[model samples]
Target: MGHAADSVTACLSKGLGASVGTIIAGSKSFIAKAKIPRKTLGSGMRQVGVLCAPALVALEENKAKILAEGLNKIKGLKVDTASVQTNIVYSDILKGSNITETHLCKILEAHGVLTMPKGPFKLRLVIHHQISESDVKYTVLHSESCNWVHW
Candidate 1:
């Protein structure tokens, strides 16, 4: 069996970058309850093997390397290193900061880095197997270089 992106958010879109959820392991009772909500949320898809195959590969191969990259790599983006336990990293903008989240997002996106904004000055950055250490450094450097006040 190959690796898989075990995620509740379909792996690809928000969870594991698989574009589909594959790994399901829970008590029968728990699964039964979850299935109802899963269906209600339209999480099911046809011929998911195509997506699952890659997800499996990823889980088996890249899990450790990706984890070791760490959440503290992104400079200027403050994240409590001890608190990060997964691929998600959250950063907040100061109340009096000149840059807004939207402005920062646009600046990052312009450089081919995409991020999700949580609030006017907050951002949620997700790290995955596709992101390399060099990529992280570049993103951090570029992010720090953004002068949103002028824009």
Candidate 2:
């Protein structure tokens, strides 16, 4: 049921919980061409199975939904919950609000929550295997109580 593409690259280090490595797949001719860069960079796939093992475990988890849903309830932020299918969550601060992504990130950081400012009004959050349910709850609770957003 997956859509077909000419070439695909999957980064195993981030969402997959792998320490390192990216898997690129394509036609034989495409791979043959890609090998030039791989060999030039001294990249090897030998013993990569050990790094790939954690992806199996990470695939079974969907902790981002728990965090996204909780964040959606905050008064000034809007989270498109349906679009969250992986470990990444993107939230937008509504226009006319007196808050920038950087400001929001600082408030979150002061409360021990770390988030990345994607744009003036957009913040990005990543949920990995290390993020627990309690961590999600604490983030949402603190975010709501921050009271930094003002239109």
Candidate 3:
């Protein structure tokens, strides 16, 4: 399980590096600072080629899915921006409505959508693998239902 988890983490880190047009180098410099015994700390798993194999497989299988999800999130953000009528859509809304982003997030969660409040009047809607087109529409509709007037 540790090997599997490490592999997944490594794969993800690599993917992140690639998306940003960065290269990841294999270095052991960071391991030198470890004070814990290898056997007891399970750090002995380093340099295990077998674990890397599964990580590689996971990366190949999941890369497309991850990219698609990212695209969906970008689309959701665009939708949110287009639907906004107020300039202070983030933190100011919270101040006037007496509702925190977390509270609104719960509301969205109940509606089968998920979001985070950015500031007092600002909120951020995050689209994930589980969110569908209908979910995005619902969020837009729900946000539109709110009557926010700027003073």
Candidate 4:
């Protein structure tokens, strides 16, 4: 049997809505061998139920819909449609926009639009169950509204 529970947290972090968890997978013996080390990092894995329970419910929700809205509703950010086979979204900051990726990230955070930087002028946004259509809209609007960047 080749049963291994790999990085299944994406099912929750990406599909459902959980803050943290990068689970790994391995055979039984391997897992047993790592038990001591895993336990050594005890509380780091605490309160998992806080994230797991919602993930279970997320399985029943429409993951594709969110992905679609996220893909379609964006304006100022450019995404390659050909590569959007999954729930991950990458937005490239338009060149000559005058604002660097770091400054834009700070602006988005100020407006409650959280995202990760993929490059000097790129951002990675993930579509999850917790994100609603309005959230996507807000991101697009705020991102495109960087008027001061033109100067």
| Top lDDT hit | 2
Clashing residue pairs in candidate 3 (N, C-alpha, C atoms within 3 angstroms): 89-121, 90-121, 90-122, 91-119, 91-120, 91-121, 91-122, 92-120, 92-121, 93-121
| Top-down lDDT ranking | 2, 4, 1, 3
Instruction: Quote model 4's TM-score.
Output: 0.53
Clashes of each: 13, 0, 10, 0
Q: Residues 1-151, candidate 1, lDDT per residue (tens digit)?
A: 2235322343343444555544464556766777788789977634657767767655554333333233234343455654445456677665555677888888889999888999766788877757666777777767766744444
Point out where model 1 deviates above 4 Å: 1-20, 27-77, 147-151
Supply the global lDDT for candidate 1.
0.61
Cα-based TM-score, every candidate: 0.54, 0.77, 0.34, 0.53
> Tens digit of lDDT per residue, candidate 3, span 1-151?
3443312123323322222221223335534433245456653544445545544444444333322333234312212333332111222243455555566566657766556677654565433323445654666555444432222
Residue 81's lDDT within candidate 2 is 97
Give the distance in Å from residue 76's predicted Cα in candidate 1 to where it truly belongs. Answer: 6.7
Question: Distance from true position, residue 115, model 2, in Å?
Answer: 1.3
- Cα deviation of 82 in candidate 4 (Å)? 3.0
**lDDT of each residue in 95-148, candidate 4, tens digit only:** 766767778788889998777888887877766776666776777677667653
Q: Residue 118 CA error for candidate 4 (Å)? A: 1.0
lDDT of each residue in 1-151, candidate 2, tens digit only = 2257878887776755767757777889988998888889998654656766766567556588888999898888899999997789999998876888998898999998999999879999998778888999999999988887653
